[model samples]
Target: MLALLRPALWLGSCLRGYHMHAASTQQRGDTSLVLVDEARRFIQDCLLRVGVSPSKVRCISEFLVVADYRGNYGSGLNRLDYYLSDLQSGHAKVGAEPSIISETVSTAHVNGNSALGVFVGNFCMDLAVKKAEDSGIGFVVAQQSHDIGMASWFTFRAAGKGLAGIVMSNSAPTMMGPNSKSASIGSNCFAFCVKGEEYHFVLDMATSVKDIGAVEWAWANDEYIPHGWAANEGGLSTCFPSLALRTPLLFPAGGHKGYCLSAVIDILCGVLSGAQYATHITMDQNQPSNLGQVFIALDPEFFLPNFMERFDDFCGRIQNSQPADDSEPIRLPGELERMHMNYVEDLRAFAYPNSLLTKYKEVAERLCVKPIELAFDRCQSRKSF
Candidate 1:
């Protein structure tokens, strides 16, 4: 009888090990794709099937995947679930077309109608670039848009069109008062793109010490957030009474300077647009309310002749500036992202956590898409970093 039980126990352990192996392989599947065009096509088809228009779907898929290809998973493919949730909850209307709500000789306001931000943002930026080309300058404001991917993408669009672009957005309240006990502000972000001589310069940053997504990711991974990294007991401000609180206010990057810019962005993106501000608005995420965004573009010709040439010269000087450390060279804002993109091209896929892999499988199942397979051959080669 004991021998019989031993065999059964051994079988059970082997089954558990098999499951673990499958989970591990699924998570570690390579993200670098030798066949990137095929992957893009696959993603586009998937998005279209879910009700996004073909053109819009193409742009959205590219925007999301660019982040993945750059190793910014927090803002990359990992965010698809959030978009799906918004679609299912009626917070985002798939296939909704945006319209110009107001306009001036040099300015326009757009109503996104709860459309995906990627499409709406691209549309607005394109309009801005066209206007700038004709009028020497253009300004655009959009409301009722859902979370747009990286602001740099929009700025780059403007740069490609020979215009300087500035983008801003107000996110759900995630910060607390400085030295206080209450939440008082939003996680605001700002970005800029300017056509340089050799390469365009792009700068993008969140006002918070780190993005809210970073904090959320930490929580998901069962990691403890550092003090001054989250809100305190009441979530009213950026202060904490003790270190044991589950959440604490996130400090602003660059201290008061970032805090000030955050306030400015909230005013422009939220107040000027007549949208909810700071803690008053709701996020697309199922969590408590808080969200907003803003974008602005400028034509360099408005200020100077041979603007692109001058800009390039300025960037060249900055690039050649002495490095603070000899081991690391100075780098422009978008240089890291560019390097990451190149790295992914050589290595086929990204390495994700086992838990994230499981979640991806679950999401795929819910959408009726084929589950991602668990095998090394299905993985992409890694680029030599």
Candidate 2:
């Protein structure tokens, strides 16, 4: 069992470390540090102007802000354009709500009615957590939702309530499946979070060697991704971001194993939820993605005594493990994201790439909303520029 778990453990460290470097160039130039409150308000105002409901803006803005705050820039406000475009194009329904199609004590199936991903995800996950609170476990699935940002957002929500959280989503197809010559599955990302006495353990990742956002970022920044991240339609590895983005047949991480896992996620989120699957789902702004997602929550207190005590002991053993690198210590699943979130909070300002900031301003202007207010001067309490 330990051996089987080693790859996942290693991947958690490697993915988090790689994200720091991959998104490093995105931290400087054309960027401004703004108070977190300012950022949240900016997003809320923009969404409001773009026809999002007043009641929904807070939840959506906070979700995106948390993504940026956690250093997951790919799924952060950088993705705001996608949402705006979808809503503008009528791909996502404005002021829409999901309806429960079927339900039991601990499970539910919902139809999002083409609502924005953030709203559907929040609604469904909150329902799942409430059910877990009442019944000790909950499972919820939804269809016809747009992009849900990061899966961890939902898992962390449950974790915040002292319950174990698990989430999975099937995105539009961009991954090359095992033994196939073309794209056959979505990136099929997933997140799992466990509540501990001190910190929550979160393992959130896509099953791809690299998500499409990485390729898009590389294209935008004129950078090159390392080999094995993507391939051409002919199935040949390529480092050219243009080709990778144009013909995004991304490699599955861990080869066949990752491919298999992605397929299973699609089964649960797509097939089981009765949402669009495989090539039928499109990521283009001209069409609704019709994404599917599942959220599960389990209350440990209902199952065992000393759950937190056991969690702490289990995590302590991993943290105390010998480190092969002198500069880096072993970390638990969600520790890296938690540490980054804290680091950003400690600074009291979040940094974004100049390009993304510019795009945000452009979108705000297009929507007839005021430009985002950026904090321009540095202070003893927080850094800005």
Candidate 3:
């Protein structure tokens, strides 16, 4: 398994690098590091006040914290506002759990009832793992859920159980097909995990040339996007952040190749699940996204002998291979995330933007909870507070 973690470079463009700063507090300068435990408590407190069930809040908070720990900050606390908006707008219901609309020995179809997507994802993946444990494989599809933060997390869960896992989701239409200017399909994402004795391979990514969230982050941070990632209304590629956000016509990862893959994922996640598909799923408040997701788990013991041993051996060979660039070493797909977790553990605190921290304070005030105290530099003012 010469697992090519393949640096986020697709189609000879560094669109993925644009999000390397996902964990950055700002474009430049000193940043504040919020204590992780404090942040978690604050999030839980706020969500509970906003009508989220205790179990649901725990799951949601842990999910977001893990994302930040793994350096996937774009999907971490950065998405808090979006989640809050959905809950406040009556788009998501508290204490909603996925119900099995249909099920078999090795397959299940669930309806999330417009609840938080993390709950749906956890339920479907857990179901898959249970079925796989008993029947060698488990396949689950869920509809009517909100956004499932990162597709990789569910697969990683299965990997922890020594099973192969594949997960995918169809999102609201915020992406375009190859050579088209208008948004049509989603940045539809897929993730896979292969278990090994001591390590595992986890690959999660959007089929688009760049993640749409990258553009959203740029828009929020008042930054510019790189060329070739997005296009203007005229179908011409542009680098201006404002134009990209307004139009947001994303390019396919490898041109037509990515477009085809995106389409297939939508078929698996949206069309197959009988949920909203293509442009039918939109960001309009009046329209329900009815997002769909699929999770599959496979037990290696059912088919292969000495699977873990062989898998580990192959991974070792790839890791020991010489790199063309001496400065950079070859890494498996999940290696960087594991490394980031280790770094985060040592820090004990998570760094975020001052503006975002202030927003959290506002949310806390609105929820009538004690705000988390933030440490800031002298250049900032009391008037800002």
Whole-model lDDT values for every prediction: 0.64, 0.78, 0.77
Cα miss at 161, model 2 (Å)? 2.3
Sequence-dependent TM-score of model 2: 0.87
lDDT of 1: 0.64
Local accuracy of candidate 1 as per-residue lDDT tens digits, 173-211: 666546655557776878898866687677877887666
Which ranges in model 1 have alpha carbons more than 4 Å from their true place?
1-49, 217-228, 231-248, 284-292, 379-385
After superposition, the stretches of candidate 3 with alpha carbons farther than 4 Å from their true spots are 1-16, 19-27, 220-222, 375-385
Query: What is the number of backbone collisions in each predicted candidate, taken in the order shown?
Result: 31, 1, 0
Ranking by lDDT: 2, 3, 1
Error of 2 at 295 (Å): 0.9
| Candidate 1 backbone clash number | 31
Q: Residue 195's C-alpha lDDT in candidate 1?
A: 67
Taking the tens digit of each residue's C-alpha lDDT, what string does model 3 give over 180-290? 778898889899999776767888888887777777655554456778788887878887767876766888888889889989999988999988988888686544448
lDDT string for model 2 (82-106, tens) is 8777888888988778999999999
Weakest lDDT window of 10 consecutive positions for candidate 2:
1-10
